[model samples]
Target: MKIYFKTFIAIIFGVSLLGCDPAEKQNKNEEFPILGRKQFVERTVNGETVVDTIDHTIPDFRLVNQDSIWVTPKSFENKVYVADFFFTSCPTICPTMKKEMLRVYNAYKNNNSVAIISHTIDPKHDTVALLKDFAQRLDVEAPKWNFVTGNKEEIYELGQKGYMVTAMEDENEEGGYIHSGAFILVDKEKHVRGVYDGTNSNDVDRLIKDIDRLLATYNEPKTKS
Candidate 1:
């Protein structure tokens, strides 16, 4: 499953440059594709056996944010959000990632339809107090940008199986851990719609534009078949 997920991610990165701007290659009315592995379930429909498709989604999670509020999937109900994994003390790419993320935070800080969540991979070192101070230094607050920490194993599981991103401790790597620099874009339904390199300005720009595109999807009027 990990191999399949990685291959899909490789494909996304491979063609990202060509399709970064949906308006350039796709109809403006077209919705962003739901990313991640999907499954085919057999079910009975009108007394006939039919196969149903179920797209991958971010599973339920419970983590405490900097403000001491219990953050859960319910916190993002009826909204689209950007999610990423990082620790406050990361020495290598985290600084750049957060710098780029600020662009995203400033873009949608006031937009209630969007939100951002950052998970700390180094939970032991990144305590709630540290995360709070970290958010203060960044000049960001919750409900707009949430810096959260929780059980180390649960966080890792969410990062890997739920968000389909890499997040784990690696002593050999700089900062004492290794995690993906990709920012995941999840829709109201919890399905991942896009992923961007959080350390790259150009990619972050694409992410900002994609957020607008994704929000527009919600405003689109429903049509009858």
Candidate 2:
């Protein structure tokens, strides 16, 4: 079985956005597909062979937030979050990404079950104080939206491997760094459910709606065997 990665999902998602009707596309009851390569493991269950599905999840990370508070998976425990990579000095898409992210922040600002985390790829320049000021300027705050910085290698690795997005330094690129402007939607279990272009307002609008859809998943009745 082949791993269905984000690139493939992105293309498919873009096509759906163009081809589908908003009113009929994503029903409130429809569950978002977990976006990532799933693994299958064979197991013996009551003397029978069974294949188990293992979802792709965000890996553990330790980074310092704007408030100088250490942030980890534990910080987002039991909550669905939106995540992206950016730096304060970025001269290109970062501004648009943040502008769109503010909408997400406001939509769920009062909803404690939701949160947002942004990683700065240029941690050397994007210090804790810088991130603090950046968030303050955006009129966002911690626990609701966290702008974080730490070891550049760890941030890049997490962005590429964990979030399945691009994050790296490139002198040839503007602002001396390059990263994906995708806002990733992670479920309560840290499973990625969707990815949208943070620079696109239409995509962000869809993301806002998807967040509600994702949250609704938790309110459903549980099934018992």
Candidate 3:
């Protein structure tokens, strides 16, 4: 009787563990690194002030979206977003990148918590009206997916420093400007979570999966009572 009781208890325990929420399990199994600078802060540790490095966050920016509305980082507060750099006239990679981006857009088009920001590296030619037209042709609606154009220098700096992507002018390139074909995933806290090649289907698929993982971080997992 004792052996049977012990076996029964063990079986119950194993079943209970398996009954835990799958979402919680998914959250536990996947971990995304928070990329960026870590700062040290003064903290009372063992009655002594100690500093620790913290996660680095993306900074604020003011730029014009497809609607010509001024968009600041505040616009994305509490929102998880993907960002990229492109121009309307790119004869090469931009189309492939945009095609992959469309996959991302379609995945979260109705989800208000998610957004896509595509900044034009060639702001000189990609005016507000031009961007609007381009977005319309691509079936992207603004505020949800913003095709932004702004001061060329600021945009370039944001690409290099803010998102850690490349953006610069190169006359030898097919396009007048050069920029990375990377899609950057940023969390609600404005920290970069992942960067994927926008031109690769597999990478974009991974990006889509990571977005779900990031979103899971914000959602409340069921309690294992």
Best by lDDT: 1
Indicate the residue-level lDDT of 219 in model 1: 84
lDDT of model 3, residue 206: 94
Clashing residue pairs in candidate 1 (N, C-alpha, C atoms within 3 angstroms): none
In order of appearance, the predictions have TM-scores of 0.87, 0.85, 0.82
Q: Model 3: how far is 131 from its true place, Å?
A: 0.3
Predicted structure 2, TM vs. truth: 0.85
Instruction: Give candidate 3's whole-model lDDT.
Output: 0.91
Model 2: lDDT to the true structure: 0.92
Which 10 successive residues of model 1 have the least lDDT summed?
A: 22-31
- The TM-score measured for candidate 3 stands at 0.82
Model 1 stretches astray by more than 4 angstroms = 1-31
Query: Model 3, poorest ten-residue lDDT window?
Result: 216-225
True-structure RMSD, every candidate: 11.3, 11.0, 7.6
Residue lDDT tens for model 2, 52-142: 9999989999999999999999999989999999999899999999999999999998999999999999888889999989889888899
Q: Supply candidate 3's per-residue lDDT for 16.
A: 82
Task: Report the C-alpha lDDT of model 1 over 142-165, residue by residue, as the tens digit.
Answer: 979999999999999999999999
Ranking 2 against 3 by TM-score, winner? 2
